[model samples]
Target: MSDKIGAAEDPLPLRWLDHVATAMNVTGSSLILALMVLIGLDVAGRNLLGAPLPGVPEMVSLSIVAIVFLQSPQTLRAGRMPRSTALLDMLTKRSPRLAAAIEDVWDMIGIGVLATVAWATWPRLVRDWERGTFIGAIGDFTAPTWPVKATIVAGSVVLVLQFLARIWRRHRIPDGKAQ
Candidate 1:
């Protein structure tokens, strides 16, 4: 009796969730591309002109975490996260519903884990924001740490939302097939 869970005709909330996920995913992707450009520029400046840009290390480290977290929600929602799916895939053929149920359980577990992480990081974010703590040297142009922490929280929250949305989706393994 089950039907497609997140059909195009779904209510507003699911659509809103999709919109936010897509936006965050796009931002994450853009950040990755920008990082590539920045690294290239830094290398060029360093090797060609012998003028290495300062604070790149700090930027790269912080951006990497933000990028992963940003894309995590969409990746998980689309069932694209790397994992051993052979067993569940085989089960899908035999019992799609059961496979889906098991998948749902995993999704719920992910939600719990990510949500806990976000909750735990909350205080750190507050401290960074209040203290205005930063990375890089005093004369090397320091970057604020709060943005990175906030991004991590944002990403975690987005991932949690995606996990819950996966439960609402009520699909099978999807295996690159579910929309």
Candidate 2:
């Protein structure tokens, strides 16, 4: 039997996770594009028609939060998150084993802190939803604030999980060689 399986033979859980991540990425990209287009139109309308788009700021803020949360896991998966590599590079050159150990420790601490913050913020998000807090803006454009808040909590949790995965994968490789 071959080690590789056909598409039909793939596990549902893995497929589902892939689908979810793909959907999140696409949705986040669409939201970002829409936000950009909307802002452009808003600015044009303001300059041309002398009237700004009502609640543009509120919409932009919410869209930005959604984009960040939805895109975070995808970014983490792609290893695109910003990092200061000067220290890590120096340490790795000196001692790869020590650098790996330090990285694992750092990831563990990050996971713990992010998980704790997510846990703490979840209830507050729920409470905000229950209270039906609205964005303060002129006119009747009321945006629900809980969803944005919850996104922050969810994104942090996902980032923590991603870091954990990275740490586990790093530990699995002998000699810390690039795969």
lDDT of each: 0.83, 0.72
Clashes of 1: 0
Model 2 poorest 10 in a row by lDDT? 1-10
- TM match of model 1 to true structure: 0.89
Error of 2 at 34 (Å): 1.1
Runs off by more than 4 Å, candidate 1: 1-6, 171-179
Clash count of each predicted structure: 0, 0
Q: TM-score per candidate, in order?
A: 0.89, 0.78
- What tens digits encode model 2's per-residue C-alpha lDDT throughout 26-65? 8889988888998999999999999887888999878787
Candidate 2 segments exceeding 4 Å error: 1-22, 173-179
Instruction: Give a tens-digit lDDT track for model 1, residues 66-167.
Output: 888888877876668899989987998899879888988898899999999999999999999999999989987699999888988998998888787777
Model 2 superposed RMSD (Cα): 5.7
Alpha-carbon deviation at 90 in model 2, angstroms: 3.1
